[model samples]
Target: MKKKVVPYLLVSPYIIHFLIFIAFPVIFSIVLTFHKWNIISPMEYTGFANYIRLFQDTLFLKSIINTLIFLVIHIPLQIIVALFLAEVLNQKIFLRGFFRAAFFLPVVVSGVVVTILWQQLYGFDTGLLNKILVTLGFGKVGWLIDPKIAMPSIAIMATWKNVGLYIVLFLVGLQTVPKHYYEAADLEGATHWQKFFKITLPMINPTIFLVVILSTVGGFSLFIEPYILTGGGPLNSTLSAVLYIYKQAFFYYHMGYSATLGLFFALIILSVVIIQKKFIEREV
Candidate 1:
């Protein structure tokens, strides 16, 4: 009895935490999806009304598209830049450790602080970027205000903020690749580019998959940059799915509908990750 009881005692904290926090919230959210409640009022069972409304919400659809656009721009650029930088830093270059730390600084900085800094740099009138453009005899380009380019601008900032972590990941992947593979390729007189394509890339497929998944998840969860920089835009161009759900839950007080949107969006994210896994597995 003592041995059995001791095992349960050791696990009780985790069990209690799971039930009180994770399990309860997830179950409650699911129940809320079928009911209408404004937090102050009694929940009224509406039974699919919220889900129906979610499908019909054009703004929500647009927000998902905006997030997808962000991923399309962000993922490829992130992988390329990070992989390139990792390749460089993996060499016996001067000040290599300092360069690695400098590149990773943005990843460790507060995201809110970074976004605010970029906001100033992207300002319409006094922005440093526009000032440079003007000095170079070019038109002042609107980074955040214009609907056409707002999402792209946010994508660029997101890449700069996140590329560091992926750089580290790629660096690990690069180092774990056996040196003898490259040595053998060199014996065959393979060029640097040929060895990179034939040996290095295939060895790091797992890391590439991880970076892609993380970038996709982060892109879907985009909020702070657009929220601060564009406030969903001059014409709702940069409204990410998470920000749209946040608006529904807090701003509009549509709790049930918000819960429904969250469930649906969660499914969408799961589907995307699954598809990504399948596609990469086949390629590998």
Candidate 2:
């Protein structure tokens, strides 16, 4: 009895913390999804009203569509760029460590700071990109302010910010591939591309799958870039699901509806991830 009690005592803090923070919030949010409540008001049972309204909400639908658009653009670009960088870093080169650090620096930076920096770079008139374009005899492009370009611009910035972590993931995966396989391929006079396709890619399928799932989830949870850079604007073109939830909860004081949105978003993410896992596992 003493030994068992002592072990439970040792783990009590973690158990208490989990109950207070994680478990409680999740359960409470689920409850809230079926009721209506503002922060200061008594809860009112609303059944599936919030859920029904969510489907009818144009902004909510737009946010979901915008998030999907971001995923479509961000995931492929992230995988390709990160894979390329990882391959480059795997080679023997001068200042290799320096280059790796440089690429990863943005990941360590604050999200707000990164967003602000890009906001400046995406400014219409004096932006660095447009300045260069103007100098090269082209018209200035609206990166963040134009509805047609805002979401894609945010997606590109997001890819740049997060690709470094995936590069390191890919680099580790690349290092794990047995060198003897490469040597055997070289002995057969296989070109670099041929060896990569035949050996490296197949061996690193798990890593590719991981990167895809992580990037997909991250894309769905997007809020900061659109929040800071575009404010979900230029005709709500950059509005993300999470940002819309934030607005509903805090900005509009619709706590119950926000909880419903959060729950639905979680389900959507889970469904997409399940489908992705099946597809990727089959291929791998």
Candidate 3:
């Protein structure tokens, strides 16, 4: 009894913190979804009105569409780039550590700072990209301001920023692949692409699954980039689900509605992850 009690005591801090910060908020938010409340007003039961309004809200629907667009572009791009970089870095090379650090620097940096930096880079007229295009006699293009390209632009930036973390993940997976398998494949006269597909990819399926799930979750929770760079865009083209929730809660002071959105978004993420796991497990 003494030994068991001591272990529980040692873990008590984390348990308490989790209850207060994580569990309580989740429970409260679920409750909030059925009630109306502003910061200054007492909560009043509304019973699914917020959820009903969410379905009818055009902006909310647009935000969901934009988020899906970001996910569609961001996930594949992230996995491909991260896998390529990880494979390259796993090989014996000069300045490998430097390259790794350079790639991962953005992950450690502040998200707001990254958004601001990219905002300047994506500027229409005097931005670095357009400046280069103009120097080469090409016309300037709107990156953030154009509804047609705004969401994709955000997706590109997000991929650039987050790919480094996935690179590290893939590197760990790559190292776990047995060298003997590759050696055996080489003796069979397998091409590089063939070896990669037959050996490297299969061995790293778990890592690929993890990267997919995390990228999907991060893609759905997008806010800061759109909030900072496009402010949900020229025609709400870059609006994201999380940003819409923020707008509802703080900007519009619709706390109940925001909680409803949050709950719905949670369901969406949960469903996607479940489906993704089933599909990947079947494929693997």
Overall lDDT per candidate, in order of appearance? 0.92, 0.93, 0.92
User: Would you give me the overall lDDT of model 1?
Assistant: 0.92
| TM-score ranking of the models | 2, 1, 3
What's the C-alpha lDDT at position 86 in model 1? 96
User: In candidate 1, how many Å is residue 90 off?
Assistant: 1.6
lDDT score for residue 110 of model 3: 91
lDDT digits (tens) for residues 226-262 of candidate 3: 9999889779999899999999999989998899999
Best by TM-score: 2
TM-score of each predicted structure versus truth? 0.94, 0.95, 0.91
**By how many angstroms RMSD does model 3 differ from the true structure?**
2.0
- Preferred candidate (TM-score higher): 1 or 3: 1
Give the per-residue lDDT digits (tens) of candidate 1, residues 1-284.
Answer: 79889989999999999999999988988999999988998999999898888879999999999999999999999999999999889888999889889889999998898899999889889999999999999999889888899999998899899899999999999999999999999999999889889998999999999999888887888888888888898799999999999999999898988988898999999999999989988887
* Candidate 3 residue spans exceeding 4 A from truth: 1-8
